[model samples]
Target: MRYDVVVIGSGFGGSVAALRLAEKGYSVLVLEAGRRFADHELPRTSWRVRRFLWAPALGCYGIQRITLLRPAGRRGAGGSRAGGTGRGKTRAGQSGGRAGVLVLSGAGVGGGSLVYANTLYEPPADFYADPQWAGITDWRAELAPYYARAKQMLGVVDYPRTTAADKVMRAVADRMGAGDTFRSTPVAVYLGRPGERVADPHFGGAGPDRAGCTHCGSCLTGCRVGAKNSLPKNYLWFAERAGARIRPLTTVVGLRPGPGGAGYLVDVRRTGAWAGGRQTIAADQVVLAAGALGTQRLLHTARATGALPAISARIGALTRTNSEAILGASVPRRAARRRRLDFTDGVAITSSFHPEPGTHVEPVRYGPGSNLMGLLQSALVPGGPCRVRRWLAALAGRPRDTVRLLSVRDWSRRTVVALVMQSVDNSLTTYHRRGRLVAGHGHGRSNPSWIPAGHRVVRLLADEIGGIPGGAVTEPFDVPMTAHILGGAVIGATRADGVVDAYHRVFGCPGLHVLDGAAVPANLGVNPSLTIVALAERAVAHWPVKGAPDRRPPAS
Candidate 1:
């Protein structure tokens, strides 16, 4: 089949591209590797790992995909896959004294929104003003209207409920003298009455039906109540209404210039099906929106195999992780007054406070009975011999008694997880090695400090919440993990500096573009979903009207 534009990934970028391009009278096709999930199909909790995680090989249909990458050299190796349920069992070469970096990301039709905490944040001006941002255009000013459009489409609103965690965050801010900065986080969730289905308030009923947030705090597990404003609920919904064709469970494997030498040829295969059934499709334009990891892997493989040798050498450099950390404290119900701390009373993140410079922390929660994540939580002890000290401090006096307190059921209800992120400019690069991708801190710098200012805020939250400090899966393994992975195929002043231009067009490959996190030049110090959407809007705004006389070139 041939399309006017083929978008390879139905994420924030691809969804926006599809809607806008179709609105311009072009036929658009979105190929997503993950199955299309209805609200009822989403798992209520993470306990059913198979249904709550995205490992097609293992038959896990969930939205989260966790991988451990062992660095091949001094640079630390790690990569994260956050879009759809397609699985690859490829492995890397074994090495010594290497710490494995934990990568956490989302999958499925809505992309990261299927598992994201729904935080719709705009980074401070400093991010755009950074020297690494090589742009002739004033991006901040240019993206303002687009950002507003994205927020409206995603149903951005302040979290609806004030929970126990909210009060604790407020207290933490007051005590730290940054009280003014403490406020409820704006999220992409419907805030109408709980359990009530409502007309599309944002789109005047033109969009899909939505349910009000139930305050279950299971936004990460997948918003089964349909309260979360994932891509499918907005952009993709409108795209379909506009006649765009969305093919879920279809994975793009390779791309080359079309036989006539003007468009492109894309090879695809059914995600869960066996081999030898690849199908090739033709397209006048191809927008690479498979996200940071997916796009990078595709381009890297294509370049290596001589599929697109014009791809820049800077393909896998400067992948940003928002300098983030997921650390929190778990309070025992017995220690709380009347055991009244219900951790699941609001959206995934309710309130946030800045504990120190370059640090931002938000109180995160999960719904009751969705306590499977408690397994990754361990007592937090900073510095040397963390593992041994953590166990010793957690037990304190009686090991047997403390063990019961660590039970998943009680731990989740009593815990307030802090989703800590930073604006500090630290990054790693991803490389294709031995048929697989590996991430590592680029040479000439020590490993990026994964737990810096964030740890201090974690400690403070533990004290205020009346809980023991806890660590995420990465901290125990002595590595780093981040949900907002940005960059890799970043934009730059010229082709020599980056793979894509400021308009998101591939430098040497006209009629081809990358419009996802892969093109992000730097970390936005916030959830990157909104930024990606706005950028896609900007990219599509420049798209020529279908069947128009040749005006601007397809790519600069």
Candidate 2:
């Protein structure tokens, strides 16, 4: 079938593009590589790893695809193979190249929203001061109204400060003399009376029915109660009602110029079926919204295979991870066994505060029965070559302490994780090797440890909370895992600087655009969902109406 616009990957960017283009009277087709999840279909708990995680080859097709690469090991890493089974660089998956790509992202129809903490924060004023983004359309001013529109569409609101974790975050902020920076996080969950089911409040009663937030703290596991405002609940939801077609479990495999150079041809393979089959379709325009990893991999493949040689050489540069760190502590022994703190009583991130300039920390939690994350933590140790050695020493020296954390009884209720993010600029370039996309850090920076500010705050929080502080397993290995991975196909003044223009159009491939995290040029030191959505809104706003004369400059 032919479409006026074919949007790939139904995440924040793709969903907004599909909805907007459809609104402009275009026949839109949105192809999602993951399955469409119904509210009841969401896993009740995250422990069902096989059902809650996403690894199609492993028969797991839910949200939350956790990719872990063992940093650059001895002899310098060349990248690792990816997939549920089979061993080859030709398979369809993101390769963890030389330096390794340790990231936490979402899958399925609604993309990250299906598994995100739902925090919708606007970046601080200084975000616009980055030299890399200077003179790029006065971003803050241009996006102000769009940010408001995105907030309204996503149902963003100030978090209700009613959880123990919330109080703890505020207290920590006050004790540090930064009380003014401590505030409730803006979240996308419904705030009507708890457990109340009401007609859609944001879409003039024309959208899906939503349930009020019950504060299950399971936003990362998928919102089974419909309180979480995932993309399917808003943009994608409305797009379908407005004549856009959404096909889930269909993965795009190839792209080539269309007949007569008026459009493009796209090939897709069916996911989760035996004896793979393929189909091709035509689209006048293509908008990539496959998140950072997915979009980077696809664009890299296209460029390397000569399918789209016109793409800029800067296809996968400036990949940012929000300078992120996952740091937190288990509840104190006295509080855990006596006071019985319920860490899972509120939204995923109830409150946050700035502990240092360009850095922000928020209290993150999981719902009851979701103790799987406990496995990702280890004893916190200071940075250096001996960090991993020290962690091992602590583990071997205190076996019982380790066992206590691994035991699942009330684990979710007894622990809180701090989601740390920073605006500090640093990046890696991704390139294809042996048919897999891998990142390469320039100039011998083999291992870049987490920012020291993150470590300091983590240590302080652990001390104040009366709990044993710990760091993510990757931290010891000089690799900090991140949830908000941005950049890669970023905006720039020319093709030499970036793959896309400020308008999100490909530098050489007209009618092809990147409107996702991949287009983001710098870290915002906050959850990037709201920023991505606002940027997408801007990308769509610049697009001429479908069937109208194309106003974009012709490829040079």
Best by lDDT: 2
**C-alpha lDDT of all candidate models, in order:** 0.76, 0.79
lDDT, candidate 2, at 527? 97
- Over the stretch 122-241, how does candidate 1's per-residue lDDT look in tens digits? 887766765545345788998899999888888888865678889888887887888988888889888888899988877888888888778888898898898888988989888998
**Where does the lowest 10-residue lDDT sum fall in candidate 1?**
88-97
What are the clashing pairs of model 2?
A: none
TM-score of each: 0.90, 0.92
Residue 86 miss distance in model 1 (angstroms): 38
Specify the highest-TM-score model's number: 2
- What TM value does model 1 have? 0.90
